[model samples]
Target chain A: EAGVAQSPRYKIIEKRQSVAFWCNPISGHATLYWYQQILGQGPKLLIQFQNNGVVDDSQLPKDRFSAERLKGVDSTLKIQPAKLEDSAVYLCASSPGTSGEQFFGPGTRLTVL
Target chain B: DQQVKQNSPSLSVQEGRISILNCDYTNSMFDYFLWYKKYPAEGPTFLISISSIKDKNEDGRFTVFLNKSAKHLSLHIVPSQPGDSAVYFCASRYPGTYKYIFGTGTRLKVLA
Candidate 1:
């Protein structure tokens, strides 16, 4: 079976610019999540979507980061006015249910100058 | 506060030896424990998992032991190989939830 897919394996942007990453989860998966992994650190959950509805986004930075999942199949995460601190990898993951091992995508590495 | 912790940042073991990586979690509600292995430039892949009720689970050369009383879990790799070199992370989730709290990771290098 195919795993989660993400677009633009790498990206570079200047500070204060806007950038977005896309994710397409595996077929029939019901839950999707976005996480940010800084160098030398574990992935930090940014947001979660159960179908087309959100499950949790408490850790998301509301001021500049936003995400959405359309029709529960594909999702996008955007960072507006990105900062240098935002330079990291954005990973997209999916699981068949509310409880299982999450399948991860290759991730998009964003480098902000 | 950090919910999960992996105190060892790195380890080196000779091939065919045993390699043990440790993790500690502060949340008592976590019922599922998992370990993931990651290679540079690649996303992490699931290695193994164990339920809270079980004190030990083994698959092939990998074994995971959970000590609820100490809130500690460990991953053991036996007969380690150079191919096993990579960063390993431990994660846990409470029952009925998919959101897992992950550790910082421990890098293991198996020297041939």
Candidate 2:
């Protein structure tokens, strides 16, 4: 079976610019998550969605970062007025349920200048 | 503060030898732990996992041991192979919570 899919394997933007990343999860998966991974660090959970409803987003930067899972199949994460510190790999993952094992996508590597 | 910690930055072991990767967590609430393997330019893949209630779980050559008292866990790969070379991350989650805390990761090199 095909795994999770993400767009724009890599991206580069200037500070204060707005950028967005897309993710398409595995078929029939019910849960989706977005994570940020800085260099030499593990992926940090940013947000999670069960179907079209958000399950958790406590770590999300409300001032600049936002994400949506419209139909429960595909999702997007956006960072407005991006900062140099925001440059990192944005990963998308999916699982069958809340406590299920997750399958990850290739991730979008963002570099902010 | 990082809840999960992998103190070792890297580990090197000869092929056919044993590789032990260690991890510790500060949160006593974490009840489930997992290990993930990642390669350069690729996302992490689930390796093995052990729940807090179990002391050890084994799968083929991979084994995970959990010590709830010490809030520590370790992954053991016996008769290691070159294919096992990769970055390994330790992750944990509290019961009934959707979020998982992960360690910084340890790069393991299995020499031939």
Candidate 3:
């Protein structure tokens, strides 16, 4: 079985530049999630999508960040005018159900100078 | 406030020895706990889990123990191997919600 897939495994951008990360989850998985992992910290939930509809995004910094899962299959996370603090690994995960073991991707490392 | 914490930043164990990793949480409302292992440049993978109502859940060489009263949990790996070396994270899910709180993670190194 194929695992979650992510593109541009590494990204570098200067501060105030916009950046985006892409994620393609495992087949047949209905629940997708995006997380941010800063150095020395655990992955923080940014948003969750249950078949293209957001289930939770309370922790997301809406003023600068946005994400969408179109057609409930693929997802994208974007950050506009990225700040130095935005430099972190962006991880995408998916699960077969709303509540179950989640499979993760290699993650896209974003470096905002 | 940080709900989940793994006070131990790192651990080292000899091959074929037992390795124990601990986790603690401040919130008493968490109902499910999970353990995930992560390799360098890779995302976390589920290792094992236990519910709030259960004290122990074992799977092969991995075992998870939950102590609700103390708000503590642990993961034990028997006869540790070099391949088992990785960062381990503990996460808890809020009751009535799918929200999960994760710890900073503990890096385990099993020396061969």
List model 3 lDDT by residue over A1-113, tens digit each: 99999998999999998988999999999999999999999999999998999999999999999999999999999999899999899999999875657888999999998
Q: For candidate 3, what is the DockQ-based docking class?
A: medium
Q: Give the alpha carbon lDDT tens digit for every residue of B1-112 in model 1.
A: 8899999999999999999999999999999999999998788899999999999999999999999999999999998999999999999996677888889999999999
lDDT of each: 0.94, 0.93, 0.94
Q: Native contact fraction of candidate 2?
A: 0.67
lDDT of 3: 0.94
Which pairs clash in model 3? none
Of the true interface contacts, each candidate retains a share of 0.48, 0.67, 0.69
List CA RMSD, all candidates: 0.9, 0.9, 0.9
The true-versus-predicted C-alpha distance at residue B68 of model 2, in Å, is 0.8
- 10 residues in a row with least lDDT, candidate 3 chain A: A95-104
Off by over 4 Å in 2: none
Q: What tier of docking accuracy does candidate 1 attain?
A: medium
Deviation of model 3 at A9, angstroms? 0.3
